[model samples]
Target: MVTRVTNQGPLTGVRVIELAGIGPGPFASMMLADLGADVVRVDRPGGGGFGAFPGDLLNRNRRSIAVDLKQPEGRDLVLDLVAGADALVEGFRPGVTERLGLGPDDCLAANPKLVYGRMTGWGQDGPLAQRAGHDIDYLALTGALHGVGRAGERPVPPMNLLGDYGGGGMMLALGVVAALYAVRGGAPGQVVDAAIVDGVSVLATQIHALRGIGLWQDPRGVNLLDGGAPFYDTYECADGRYVAVGALEPQFYAELVRLTGFPPDGGDGPQDAGAAAGGEALDRDDPANWPALRAAWARLFRTRTR
Candidate 1:
Protein backbone atom coordinates (compact mmCIF):
# COMPACT_ATOMS: atom_id res chain seq x y z
CA MET A 1 0.00 0.00 0.00
CA VAL A 2 1.16 3.53 -0.85
CA THR A 3 0.99 5.57 2.36
CA ARG A 4 0.47 9.32 2.26
CA VAL A 5 1.38 11.13 5.44
CA THR A 6 -0.64 14.25 6.21
CA ASN A 7 0.98 16.40 8.86
CA GLN A 8 -0.78 19.11 10.91
CA GLY A 9 -0.67 22.40 9.02
CA PRO A 10 1.36 25.52 9.79
CA LEU A 11 -1.69 27.76 10.44
CA THR A 12 -3.45 25.17 12.56
CA GLY A 13 -4.22 27.63 15.39
CA VAL A 14 -4.65 30.93 13.53
CA ARG A 15 -8.03 32.67 13.38
CA VAL A 16 -9.26 34.93 10.56
CA ILE A 17 -12.47 36.93 10.10
CA GLU A 18 -13.52 37.57 6.51
CA LEU A 19 -16.00 40.22 5.34
CA ALA A 20 -17.52 38.66 2.26
CA GLY A 21 -17.86 40.45 -1.08
CA ILE A 22 -16.35 38.59 -4.03
CA GLY A 23 -13.16 37.74 -5.92
CA PRO A 24 -9.97 38.18 -3.85
CA GLY A 25 -11.51 38.48 -0.38
CA PRO A 26 -12.96 34.97 -0.37
CA PHE A 27 -9.96 33.52 -2.17
CA ALA A 28 -7.53 34.84 0.47
CA SER A 29 -9.75 33.43 3.18
CA MET A 30 -9.88 30.05 1.46
CA MET A 31 -6.07 29.91 1.27
CA LEU A 32 -5.89 30.63 4.99
CA ALA A 33 -8.42 27.87 5.66
CA ASP A 34 -6.47 25.40 3.51
CA LEU A 35 -3.51 25.98 5.83
CA GLY A 36 -5.76 25.02 8.78
CA ALA A 37 -6.79 28.48 9.97
CA ASP A 38 -10.28 28.94 11.34
CA VAL A 39 -11.78 31.48 8.92
CA VAL A 40 -15.29 32.83 9.57
CA ARG A 41 -17.01 34.52 6.65
CA VAL A 42 -19.43 37.30 7.47
CA ASP A 43 -22.10 37.35 4.75
CA ARG A 44 -24.86 39.91 4.25
CA PRO A 45 -28.35 39.05 5.49
CA GLY A 46 -30.59 36.97 3.17
CA GLY A 47 -27.34 35.21 2.20
CA GLY A 48 -25.65 37.42 -0.42
CA GLY A 49 -28.94 39.00 -1.57
CA PHE A 50 -27.44 40.35 -4.79
CA GLY A 51 -27.16 37.00 -6.55
CA ALA A 52 -27.62 33.22 -6.69
CA PHE A 53 -25.69 30.64 -4.66
CA PRO A 54 -22.03 31.66 -4.37
CA GLY A 55 -20.84 28.15 -5.21
CA ASP A 56 -17.35 29.34 -6.02
CA LEU A 57 -14.58 27.07 -4.68
CA LEU A 58 -12.82 30.10 -3.22
CA ASN A 59 -15.74 30.59 -0.81
CA ARG A 60 -15.49 27.03 0.46
CA ASN A 61 -13.65 25.87 3.71
CA ARG A 62 -15.20 28.57 5.90
CA ARG A 63 -18.19 29.01 8.17
CA SER A 64 -20.75 31.71 7.23
CA ILE A 65 -22.60 34.13 9.51
CA ALA A 66 -25.30 36.35 7.98
CA VAL A 67 -25.62 39.79 9.54
CA ASP A 68 -27.21 43.14 8.64
CA LEU A 69 -24.47 45.74 9.10
CA LYS A 70 -26.97 48.53 8.43
CA GLN A 71 -28.41 47.92 11.89
CA PRO A 72 -26.64 48.89 15.14
CA GLU A 73 -27.14 45.37 16.51
CA GLY A 74 -25.31 43.86 13.55
CA ARG A 75 -22.43 46.35 13.93
CA ASP A 76 -22.13 45.41 17.61
CA LEU A 77 -22.22 41.73 16.69
CA VAL A 78 -19.23 42.13 14.35
CA LEU A 79 -17.36 44.11 16.99
CA ASP A 80 -17.89 41.24 19.42
CA LEU A 81 -16.54 38.80 16.84
CA VAL A 82 -13.53 41.06 16.17
CA ALA A 83 -12.56 40.96 19.83
CA GLY A 84 -11.25 37.42 19.48
CA ALA A 85 -9.99 37.44 15.87
CA ASP A 86 -6.35 37.68 14.78
CA ALA A 87 -6.90 39.03 11.26
CA LEU A 88 -9.66 40.52 9.09
CA VAL A 89 -9.84 40.51 5.30
CA GLU A 90 -12.01 42.77 3.13
CA GLY A 91 -12.07 43.62 -0.60
CA PHE A 92 -14.22 46.75 -0.68
CA ARG A 93 -13.02 49.64 -2.83
CA PRO A 94 -11.33 51.85 -0.18
CA GLY A 95 -14.08 53.80 1.66
CA VAL A 96 -17.01 51.40 1.30
CA THR A 97 -16.16 49.59 4.55
CA GLU A 98 -15.62 52.90 6.35
CA ARG A 99 -19.10 53.95 5.23
CA LEU A 100 -20.39 50.66 6.59
CA GLY A 101 -18.81 51.59 9.99
CA LEU A 102 -16.60 48.45 9.89
CA GLY A 103 -13.33 49.77 8.60
CA PRO A 104 -9.85 48.95 9.96
CA ASP A 105 -10.08 51.81 12.47
CA ASP A 106 -13.35 50.43 13.88
CA CYS A 107 -12.06 46.85 14.03
CA LEU A 108 -8.56 47.71 15.34
CA ALA A 109 -10.08 49.98 18.02
CA ALA A 110 -11.78 46.86 19.40
CA ASN A 111 -8.73 44.59 18.96
CA PRO A 112 -5.47 46.52 19.07
CA LYS A 113 -3.51 43.67 17.47
CA LEU A 114 -5.83 42.96 14.56
CA VAL A 115 -4.20 42.66 11.13
CA TYR A 116 -6.45 44.30 8.53
CA GLY A 117 -5.92 43.17 4.92
CA ARG A 118 -7.46 45.28 2.14
CA MET A 119 -7.68 44.09 -1.47
CA THR A 120 -8.40 46.24 -4.55
CA GLY A 121 -7.36 46.87 -8.16
CA TRP A 122 -5.89 50.41 -8.32
CA GLY A 123 -4.96 50.69 -4.63
CA GLN A 124 -6.33 52.83 -1.73
CA ASP A 125 -5.08 56.31 -2.79
CA GLY A 126 -5.12 56.46 -6.60
CA PRO A 127 -7.87 58.35 -8.49
CA LEU A 128 -8.97 55.12 -10.18
CA ALA A 129 -9.08 53.28 -6.86
CA GLN A 130 -12.71 54.13 -6.40
CA ARG A 131 -13.57 53.48 -10.05
CA ALA A 132 -14.71 50.05 -11.21
CA GLY A 133 -12.36 47.70 -13.10
CA HIS A 134 -11.65 44.01 -13.70
CA ASP A 135 -8.61 41.73 -14.25
CA ILE A 136 -8.06 42.61 -17.92
CA ASP A 137 -8.24 46.37 -17.25
CA TYR A 138 -5.87 46.13 -14.30
CA LEU A 139 -3.34 44.01 -16.21
CA ALA A 140 -3.63 46.34 -19.23
CA LEU A 141 -2.59 49.31 -17.06
CA THR A 142 0.40 47.33 -15.72
CA GLY A 143 1.82 46.37 -19.17
CA ALA A 144 1.30 42.68 -18.36
CA LEU A 145 -1.27 42.28 -21.12
CA HIS A 146 1.12 43.80 -23.66
CA GLY A 147 3.78 41.18 -22.95
CA VAL A 148 1.39 38.35 -23.87
CA GLY A 149 0.09 37.08 -27.25
CA ARG A 150 1.80 36.90 -30.68
CA ALA A 151 3.40 39.67 -32.73
CA GLY A 152 1.17 41.96 -34.91
CA GLU A 153 -1.91 40.67 -33.10
CA ARG A 154 -4.14 42.22 -30.44
CA PRO A 155 -3.03 41.47 -26.84
CA VAL A 156 -4.75 38.34 -25.60
CA PRO A 157 -6.23 38.55 -22.11
CA PRO A 158 -5.02 35.61 -19.95
CA MET A 159 -8.46 34.86 -18.45
CA ASN A 160 -8.22 36.70 -15.08
CA LEU A 161 -5.34 34.50 -13.83
CA LEU A 162 -2.79 37.30 -13.81
CA GLY A 163 -4.58 40.19 -12.10
CA ASP A 164 -7.35 38.77 -9.94
CA TYR A 165 -5.91 35.49 -8.64
CA GLY A 166 -2.13 36.00 -8.81
CA GLY A 167 -1.88 39.77 -8.22
CA GLY A 168 -4.90 40.53 -6.03
CA GLY A 169 -5.91 37.46 -4.00
CA MET A 170 -2.59 35.55 -3.59
CA MET A 171 -0.74 38.79 -2.80
CA LEU A 172 -3.26 39.64 -0.07
CA ALA A 173 -2.78 36.21 1.48
CA LEU A 174 0.99 36.71 1.53
CA GLY A 175 0.58 40.14 3.13
CA VAL A 176 -1.74 38.83 5.82
CA VAL A 177 0.68 36.02 6.70
CA ALA A 178 3.60 38.45 6.84
CA ALA A 179 1.66 40.83 9.05
CA LEU A 180 0.77 37.99 11.40
CA TYR A 181 4.47 37.09 11.68
CA ALA A 182 5.39 40.74 12.35
CA VAL A 183 2.74 41.12 15.05
CA ARG A 184 3.94 38.02 16.89
CA GLY A 185 6.81 40.09 18.34
CA GLY A 186 4.80 43.09 19.71
CA ALA A 187 4.28 44.86 16.36
CA PRO A 188 1.11 46.97 16.54
CA GLY A 189 -1.94 46.66 14.29
CA GLN A 190 -1.51 47.44 10.58
CA VAL A 191 -3.20 47.46 7.16
CA VAL A 192 -2.11 45.67 4.00
CA ASP A 193 -2.92 47.56 0.77
CA ALA A 194 -2.84 44.87 -1.90
CA ALA A 195 -3.62 46.30 -5.33
CA ILE A 196 -3.85 44.13 -8.43
CA VAL A 197 -1.98 46.64 -10.64
CA ASP A 198 0.78 47.04 -8.06
CA GLY A 199 1.14 43.30 -7.53
CA VAL A 200 1.06 42.65 -11.30
CA SER A 201 3.95 45.08 -11.71
CA VAL A 202 5.83 43.26 -8.96
CA LEU A 203 5.12 39.97 -10.74
CA ALA A 204 6.89 41.45 -13.80
CA THR A 205 10.15 41.88 -11.88
CA GLN A 206 11.88 39.01 -13.70
CA ILE A 207 10.83 40.38 -17.11
CA HIS A 208 12.15 43.77 -16.05
CA ALA A 209 15.45 42.15 -15.06
CA LEU A 210 15.55 40.45 -18.46
CA ARG A 211 15.08 43.81 -20.13
CA GLY A 212 17.87 45.34 -18.03
CA ILE A 213 20.23 42.52 -19.10
CA GLY A 214 19.28 43.01 -22.82
CA LEU A 215 17.72 39.54 -22.92
CA TRP A 216 14.15 40.67 -23.49
CA GLN A 217 13.20 42.19 -26.85
CA ASP A 218 10.57 44.91 -27.35
CA PRO A 219 8.38 42.98 -29.79
CA ARG A 220 6.47 39.95 -28.54
CA GLY A 221 7.22 36.44 -29.95
CA VAL A 222 10.69 37.69 -30.95
CA ASN A 223 12.72 36.61 -27.91
CA LEU A 224 14.29 33.25 -27.04
CA LEU A 225 11.63 32.19 -24.49
CA ASP A 226 8.89 34.12 -26.28
CA GLY A 227 8.68 31.90 -29.39
CA GLY A 228 11.56 33.58 -31.22
CA ALA A 229 13.85 30.53 -30.99
CA PRO A 230 12.38 27.69 -33.09
CA PHE A 231 13.92 25.20 -30.64
CA TYR A 232 11.96 26.70 -27.72
CA ASP A 233 8.43 26.70 -29.12
CA THR A 234 5.38 24.58 -29.89
CA TYR A 235 4.66 22.85 -33.22
CA GLU A 236 1.51 21.40 -34.75
CA CYS A 237 1.43 17.62 -35.19
CA ALA A 238 -0.21 15.59 -37.98
CA ASP A 239 -3.41 15.37 -35.88
CA GLY A 240 -3.53 19.19 -35.77
CA ARG A 241 -2.79 19.18 -32.02
CA TYR A 242 0.43 20.62 -30.59
CA VAL A 243 3.59 19.49 -28.77
CA ALA A 244 6.09 21.77 -27.04
CA VAL A 245 9.83 21.57 -27.73
CA GLY A 246 12.26 23.24 -25.26
CA ALA A 247 15.76 22.05 -26.06
CA LEU A 248 17.69 25.12 -24.90
CA GLU A 249 21.00 23.69 -23.58
CA PRO A 250 23.57 21.83 -25.67
CA GLN A 251 23.03 18.48 -23.91
CA PHE A 252 19.25 18.82 -24.06
CA TYR A 253 19.45 19.82 -27.71
CA ALA A 254 21.64 16.78 -28.36
CA GLU A 255 19.10 14.57 -26.60
CA LEU A 256 16.28 16.14 -28.61
CA VAL A 257 18.24 15.49 -31.83
CA ARG A 258 18.88 11.88 -30.79
CA LEU A 259 15.24 11.28 -29.80
CA THR A 260 13.88 12.95 -32.96
CA GLY A 261 16.48 11.01 -35.02
CA PHE A 262 17.91 14.27 -36.42
CA PRO A 263 21.56 14.70 -37.50
CA PRO A 264 23.92 13.40 -34.76
CA ASP A 265 27.15 14.49 -36.58
CA GLY A 266 25.96 17.72 -38.22
CA GLY A 267 24.60 15.65 -41.11
CA ASP A 268 20.95 14.59 -41.49
CA GLY A 269 19.63 11.56 -39.53
CA PRO A 270 16.80 9.18 -40.40
CA GLN A 271 14.11 11.64 -39.32
CA ASP A 272 15.40 14.28 -41.79
CA ALA A 273 16.01 11.82 -44.65
CA GLY A 274 13.62 13.67 -46.96
CA ALA A 275 15.17 17.06 -46.13
CA ALA A 276 18.72 15.63 -46.39
CA ALA A 277 18.00 14.55 -49.97
CA GLY A 278 17.23 18.23 -50.63
CA GLY A 279 20.68 19.23 -49.17
CA GLU A 280 19.31 20.30 -45.76
CA ALA A 281 20.20 19.33 -42.17
CA LEU A 282 18.01 19.94 -39.07
CA ASP A 283 18.90 23.41 -37.86
CA ARG A 284 16.47 24.22 -35.05
CA ASP A 285 17.65 27.83 -34.71
CA ASP A 286 16.75 28.48 -38.35
CA PRO A 287 13.04 29.36 -38.64
CA ALA A 288 13.11 28.36 -42.34
CA ASN A 289 13.94 24.78 -41.29
CA TRP A 290 10.88 24.60 -39.02
CA PRO A 291 8.57 23.25 -41.72
CA ALA A 292 10.81 20.26 -42.41
CA LEU A 293 11.26 19.47 -38.73
CA ARG A 294 7.55 19.89 -38.11
CA ALA A 295 6.72 17.53 -40.98
CA ALA A 296 9.14 14.90 -39.65
CA TRP A 297 7.69 15.17 -36.09
CA ALA A 298 4.18 14.92 -37.57
CA ARG A 299 5.05 11.74 -39.44
CA LEU A 300 6.52 10.19 -36.25
CA PHE A 301 3.44 11.05 -34.17
CA ARG A 302 1.02 9.88 -36.89
CA THR A 303 2.67 6.43 -37.16
CA ARG A 304 2.59 5.95 -33.37
CA THR A 305 -1.06 6.93 -32.90
CA ARG A 306 -3.75 4.27 -33.55
Candidate 2:
Protein backbone atom coordinates (compact mmCIF):
# COMPACT_ATOMS: atom_id res chain seq x y z
CA MET A 1 0.00 0.00 0.00
CA VAL A 2 1.17 3.52 -0.85
CA THR A 3 0.95 6.37 1.68
CA ARG A 4 1.62 10.09 1.98
CA VAL A 5 2.37 12.18 5.05
CA THR A 6 -0.21 14.78 6.08
CA ASN A 7 -0.08 17.59 8.62
CA GLN A 8 -1.60 16.87 12.00
CA GLY A 9 -5.35 17.56 12.21
CA PRO A 10 -8.54 15.88 13.40
CA LEU A 11 -8.44 13.31 10.58
CA THR A 12 -4.69 12.74 10.76
CA GLY A 13 -4.93 8.98 10.53
CA VAL A 14 -7.68 8.77 7.92
CA ARG A 15 -7.06 7.80 4.31
CA VAL A 16 -9.24 8.64 1.30
CA ILE A 17 -9.25 7.85 -2.41
CA GLU A 18 -10.61 10.51 -4.75
CA LEU A 19 -11.55 9.78 -8.37
CA ALA A 20 -10.92 13.03 -10.17
CA GLY A 21 -13.50 14.77 -12.28
CA ILE A 22 -14.17 18.48 -12.21
CA GLY A 23 -15.65 20.82 -9.65
CA PRO A 24 -17.06 18.80 -6.72
CA GLY A 25 -14.55 15.97 -6.83
CA PRO A 26 -11.57 18.22 -6.12
CA PHE A 27 -13.66 20.30 -3.75
CA ALA A 28 -14.80 17.40 -1.54
CA SER A 29 -11.35 15.84 -1.48
CA MET A 30 -9.96 19.25 -0.60
CA MET A 31 -12.14 19.34 2.50
CA LEU A 32 -10.95 15.91 3.56
CA ALA A 33 -7.35 16.80 2.83
CA ASP A 34 -7.70 20.07 4.72
CA LEU A 35 -8.64 18.10 7.82
CA GLY A 36 -5.41 16.08 7.51
CA ALA A 37 -6.81 13.02 5.78
CA ASP A 38 -4.27 11.39 3.48
CA VAL A 39 -6.34 12.04 0.35
CA VAL A 40 -4.79 10.91 -2.96
CA ARG A 41 -6.54 11.94 -6.15
CA VAL A 42 -6.51 9.49 -9.09
CA ASP A 43 -6.23 11.62 -12.17
CA ARG A 44 -6.37 10.49 -15.79
CA PRO A 45 -3.02 9.87 -17.54
CA GLY A 46 -3.23 12.94 -19.81
CA GLY A 47 -3.42 16.39 -18.18
CA GLY A 48 -5.83 18.22 -20.50
CA GLY A 49 -8.70 19.36 -18.23
CA PHE A 50 -8.32 21.65 -15.23
CA GLY A 51 -5.66 19.43 -13.67
CA ALA A 52 -3.67 20.42 -10.65
CA PHE A 53 -1.93 23.78 -10.88
CA PRO A 54 0.55 25.11 -8.34
CA GLY A 55 -1.80 28.03 -7.58
CA ASP A 56 -4.98 25.92 -7.56
CA LEU A 57 -6.01 26.28 -3.92
CA LEU A 58 -8.76 23.69 -4.09
CA ASN A 59 -6.28 21.11 -5.36
CA ARG A 60 -3.90 21.90 -2.53
CA ASN A 61 -3.29 19.82 0.68
CA ARG A 62 -3.15 16.61 -1.35
CA ARG A 63 -1.04 14.74 -3.93
CA SER A 64 -2.28 13.07 -7.13
CA ILE A 65 -1.40 9.99 -9.18
CA ALA A 66 -2.36 9.60 -12.83
CA VAL A 67 -3.42 6.30 -14.39
CA ASP A 68 -5.28 5.37 -17.59
CA LEU A 69 -8.55 3.79 -16.48
CA LYS A 70 -9.19 2.51 -20.03
CA GLN A 71 -6.60 -0.19 -19.31
CA PRO A 72 -7.43 -3.14 -17.02
CA GLU A 73 -4.18 -2.74 -15.05
CA GLY A 74 -4.95 0.91 -14.33
CA ARG A 75 -8.37 0.10 -12.89
CA ASP A 76 -6.78 -2.68 -10.82
CA LEU A 77 -4.28 -0.17 -9.44
CA VAL A 78 -7.10 2.06 -8.15
CA LEU A 79 -8.92 -0.88 -6.59
CA ASP A 80 -5.65 -1.80 -4.90
CA LEU A 81 -5.48 1.68 -3.34
CA VAL A 82 -9.13 1.42 -2.29
CA ALA A 83 -8.25 -1.66 -0.20
CA GLY A 84 -6.31 0.62 2.17
CA ALA A 85 -8.64 3.65 2.02
CA ASP A 86 -11.35 4.45 4.54
CA ALA A 87 -13.45 6.38 2.02
CA LEU A 88 -13.76 7.11 -1.70
CA VAL A 89 -15.19 10.19 -3.48
CA GLU A 90 -16.32 10.47 -7.09
CA GLY A 91 -18.57 12.90 -8.98
CA PHE A 92 -19.37 10.96 -12.10
CA ARG A 93 -22.87 10.57 -13.47
CA PRO A 94 -24.97 7.44 -12.66
CA GLY A 95 -23.35 4.43 -14.27
CA VAL A 96 -20.03 5.89 -15.42
CA THR A 97 -18.15 4.29 -12.51
CA GLU A 98 -19.75 0.90 -13.20
CA ARG A 99 -18.57 1.07 -16.80
CA LEU A 100 -15.07 1.92 -15.52
CA GLY A 101 -15.24 -1.20 -13.34
CA LEU A 102 -14.83 0.89 -10.16
CA GLY A 103 -18.42 1.08 -9.02
CA PRO A 104 -19.62 0.74 -5.39
CA ASP A 105 -19.49 -3.04 -5.48
CA ASP A 106 -15.95 -3.07 -6.82
CA CYS A 107 -14.65 -0.65 -4.17
CA LEU A 108 -16.70 -2.11 -1.30
CA ALA A 109 -15.35 -5.56 -2.10
CA ALA A 110 -11.87 -4.14 -1.77
CA ASN A 111 -12.73 -2.68 1.63
CA PRO A 112 -15.97 -3.42 3.44
CA LYS A 113 -15.53 -0.35 5.65
CA LEU A 114 -15.38 2.01 2.70
CA VAL A 115 -17.55 5.08 2.61
CA TYR A 116 -18.52 5.35 -1.05
CA GLY A 117 -19.38 8.96 -1.82
CA ARG A 118 -21.10 9.61 -5.15
CA MET A 119 -21.70 13.19 -6.21
CA THR A 120 -24.05 14.08 -9.06
CA GLY A 121 -26.49 16.71 -10.23
CA TRP A 122 -29.69 14.64 -10.24
CA GLY A 123 -28.73 11.71 -7.96
CA GLN A 124 -28.07 7.98 -8.41
CA ASP A 125 -31.64 7.13 -9.38
CA GLY A 126 -34.05 9.73 -10.74
CA PRO A 127 -35.99 10.64 -13.86
CA LEU A 128 -33.14 12.86 -15.07
CA ALA A 129 -30.30 10.95 -13.42
CA GLN A 130 -28.59 10.35 -16.75
CA ARG A 131 -29.25 13.87 -18.09
CA ALA A 132 -26.45 16.42 -18.45
CA GLY A 133 -26.67 19.54 -16.26
CA HIS A 134 -24.62 22.25 -14.62
CA ASP A 135 -24.84 24.32 -11.44
CA ILE A 136 -27.40 26.70 -13.01
CA ASP A 137 -29.60 23.80 -14.02
CA TYR A 138 -29.47 22.22 -10.56
CA LEU A 139 -30.29 25.51 -8.80
CA ALA A 140 -33.14 26.14 -11.23
CA LEU A 141 -34.63 22.72 -10.50
CA THR A 142 -34.35 23.09 -6.70
CA GLY A 143 -36.39 26.35 -6.20
CA ALA A 144 -33.30 28.22 -4.93
CA LEU A 145 -32.94 30.13 -8.21
CA HIS A 146 -36.40 31.72 -8.00
CA GLY A 147 -36.01 32.87 -4.37
CA VAL A 148 -33.06 35.16 -5.11
CA GLY A 149 -33.09 38.47 -7.06
CA ARG A 150 -35.87 41.13 -7.36
CA ALA A 151 -39.60 40.63 -7.77
CA GLY A 152 -40.41 41.66 -11.36
CA GLU A 153 -37.01 40.93 -12.92
CA ARG A 154 -35.80 37.52 -13.96
CA PRO A 155 -34.02 35.60 -11.24
CA VAL A 156 -30.26 35.96 -11.51
CA PRO A 157 -28.12 32.88 -11.01
CA PRO A 158 -26.17 33.09 -7.75
CA MET A 159 -23.31 31.54 -9.72
CA ASN A 160 -21.89 28.14 -8.68
CA LEU A 161 -21.79 28.97 -5.00
CA LEU A 162 -25.17 27.49 -4.19
CA GLY A 163 -25.11 24.35 -6.31
CA ASP A 164 -21.55 23.39 -7.20
CA TYR A 165 -20.00 24.13 -3.81
CA GLY A 166 -22.66 24.66 -1.16
CA GLY A 167 -24.86 21.82 -2.35
CA GLY A 168 -22.40 19.64 -4.25
CA GLY A 169 -18.90 19.48 -2.75
CA MET A 170 -19.85 20.65 0.72
CA MET A 171 -22.68 18.16 1.04
CA LEU A 172 -20.63 15.30 -0.34
CA ALA A 173 -17.85 15.98 2.12
CA LEU A 174 -20.31 16.11 4.99
CA GLY A 175 -21.89 12.85 3.84
CA VAL A 176 -18.55 11.08 3.59
CA VAL A 177 -17.51 12.22 7.04
CA ALA A 178 -20.82 11.21 8.53
CA ALA A 179 -20.64 7.81 6.86
CA LEU A 180 -17.14 7.27 8.16
CA TYR A 181 -18.41 7.90 11.68
CA ALA A 182 -21.14 5.33 11.13
CA VAL A 183 -18.52 2.82 10.11
CA ARG A 184 -16.68 3.44 13.38
CA GLY A 185 -19.89 2.65 15.25
CA GLY A 186 -19.93 -0.94 13.93
CA ALA A 187 -22.25 -0.08 11.05
CA PRO A 188 -21.47 -1.33 7.58
CA GLY A 189 -20.24 1.29 5.14
CA GLN A 190 -22.75 2.44 2.54
CA VAL A 191 -23.15 4.70 -0.45
CA VAL A 192 -23.63 8.40 0.17
CA ASP A 193 -25.49 9.70 -2.89
CA ALA A 194 -25.20 13.45 -2.53
CA ALA A 195 -26.97 14.86 -5.53
CA ILE A 196 -26.89 18.62 -6.21
CA VAL A 197 -30.67 18.72 -6.53
CA ASP A 198 -31.12 16.87 -3.23
CA GLY A 199 -28.56 18.97 -1.38
CA VAL A 200 -29.90 22.27 -2.79
CA SER A 201 -33.44 21.17 -1.93
CA VAL A 202 -32.33 20.27 1.61
CA LEU A 203 -30.72 23.70 1.97
CA ALA A 204 -34.08 25.27 1.14
CA THR A 205 -35.82 23.47 4.02
CA GLN A 206 -36.30 26.65 6.05
CA ILE A 207 -38.11 28.37 3.19
CA HIS A 208 -40.30 25.31 2.75
CA ALA A 209 -41.07 25.14 6.46
CA LEU A 210 -41.82 28.85 6.71
CA ARG A 211 -44.08 28.64 3.67
CA GLY A 212 -45.94 25.69 5.17
CA ILE A 213 -46.72 27.79 8.28
CA GLY A 214 -47.98 30.78 6.22
CA LEU A 215 -44.96 32.84 7.36
CA TRP A 216 -43.55 32.79 3.81
CA GLN A 217 -44.97 33.14 0.32
CA ASP A 218 -44.82 30.71 -2.58
CA PRO A 219 -44.12 33.44 -5.12
CA ARG A 220 -40.50 34.49 -5.61
CA GLY A 221 -39.04 37.66 -4.02
CA VAL A 222 -42.34 38.61 -2.36
CA ASN A 223 -41.66 37.03 1.04
CA LEU A 224 -39.94 38.27 4.18
CA LEU A 225 -36.44 36.99 3.45
CA ASP A 226 -36.78 37.29 -0.30
CA GLY A 227 -37.11 40.81 -1.77
CA GLY A 228 -40.66 40.99 -0.34
CA ALA A 229 -40.30 42.81 2.96
CA PRO A 230 -38.74 46.22 2.44
CA PHE A 231 -36.97 46.08 5.81
CA TYR A 232 -35.12 42.94 4.70
CA ASP A 233 -34.08 44.05 1.23
CA THR A 234 -31.31 46.08 -0.39
CA TYR A 235 -31.63 49.75 -1.26
CA GLU A 236 -29.52 52.15 -3.29
CA CYS A 237 -28.24 55.37 -1.71
CA ALA A 238 -27.84 58.82 -3.28
CA ASP A 239 -24.20 58.00 -4.08
CA GLY A 240 -25.35 54.95 -6.13
CA ARG A 241 -23.90 52.45 -3.64
CA TYR A 242 -26.21 49.75 -2.31
CA VAL A 243 -26.67 48.62 1.29
CA ALA A 244 -28.57 45.55 2.37
CA VAL A 245 -30.82 45.58 5.43
CA GLY A 246 -32.13 42.54 7.29
CA ALA A 247 -34.03 44.03 10.18
CA LEU A 248 -36.48 41.17 10.44
CA GLU A 249 -36.98 41.01 14.20
CA PRO A 250 -38.97 43.79 15.84
CA GLN A 251 -36.01 45.25 17.76
CA PHE A 252 -33.60 45.24 14.81
CA TYR A 253 -36.23 46.57 12.40
CA ALA A 254 -36.87 49.42 14.86
CA GLU A 255 -33.15 50.21 14.72
CA LEU A 256 -33.25 50.00 10.93
CA VAL A 257 -36.16 52.42 10.75
CA ARG A 258 -34.56 54.85 13.18
CA LEU A 259 -31.18 54.78 11.43
CA THR A 260 -32.77 55.29 8.02
CA GLY A 261 -34.65 58.39 9.35
CA PHE A 262 -38.05 56.70 8.86
CA PRO A 263 -39.04 56.43 12.49
CA PRO A 264 -42.33 54.68 13.13
CA ASP A 265 -42.95 57.51 15.57
CA GLY A 266 -42.24 61.16 14.78
CA GLY A 267 -39.33 61.65 17.22
CA ASP A 268 -36.28 59.38 17.01
CA GLY A 269 -32.71 59.72 18.19
CA PRO A 270 -31.46 56.19 17.75
CA GLN A 271 -33.11 52.87 18.34
CA ASP A 272 -31.03 50.03 19.68
CA ALA A 273 -31.11 46.46 18.41
CA GLY A 274 -33.20 45.71 21.50
CA ALA A 275 -35.72 48.45 20.64
CA ALA A 276 -38.92 47.72 18.79
CA ALA A 277 -38.53 46.93 15.08
CA GLY A 278 -42.28 46.95 14.63
CA GLY A 279 -45.51 46.53 16.58
CA GLU A 280 -45.26 43.17 18.39
CA ALA A 281 -42.14 42.54 16.29
CA LEU A 282 -43.85 40.64 13.48
CA ASP A 283 -47.37 42.08 13.66
CA ARG A 284 -48.51 42.19 10.05
CA ASP A 285 -51.57 44.24 11.01
CA ASP A 286 -49.52 47.03 12.65
CA PRO A 287 -50.54 50.42 11.15
CA ALA A 288 -46.97 51.58 10.33
CA ASN A 289 -46.66 48.36 8.38
CA TRP A 290 -45.06 47.09 5.19
CA PRO A 291 -46.64 48.93 2.25
CA ALA A 292 -46.33 52.33 3.91
CA LEU A 293 -43.15 51.58 5.86
CA ARG A 294 -41.59 50.08 2.77
CA ALA A 295 -42.27 53.24 0.78
CA ALA A 296 -41.03 55.36 3.68
CA TRP A 297 -37.76 53.48 3.98
CA ALA A 298 -37.28 53.49 0.20
CA ARG A 299 -37.57 57.26 0.07
CA LEU A 300 -35.44 57.77 3.18
CA PHE A 301 -32.62 55.51 1.96
CA ARG A 302 -32.62 57.15 -1.46
CA THR A 303 -31.91 60.51 0.18
CA ARG A 304 -28.88 59.31 2.17
CA THR A 305 -25.28 58.84 1.06
CA ARG A 306 -23.83 55.42 0.34
Model number with the top lDDT: 2
Prediction-by-prediction clash tally:
0, 2
User: Model 2 segments beyond 4 Å from truth?
Assistant: 1-5, 50-54, 263-291
Name the regions of candidate 1 deviating beyond 4 angstroms: 1-8, 48-54, 263-269, 272-306
Root-mean-square deviation of every model: 5.3, 4.0
Candidate No. with top TM-score: 2
Q: Candidate 2 at 262: error in angstroms? A: 2.9
Alpha carbon lDDT of each predicted model? 0.78, 0.81
lDDT of 1 by residue, 143-190 (tens): 888878776777888888889889989999999999999998889988
TM-scores for the candidates: 0.84, 0.85
Scored by Cα lDDT, where does model 1 land? 0.78
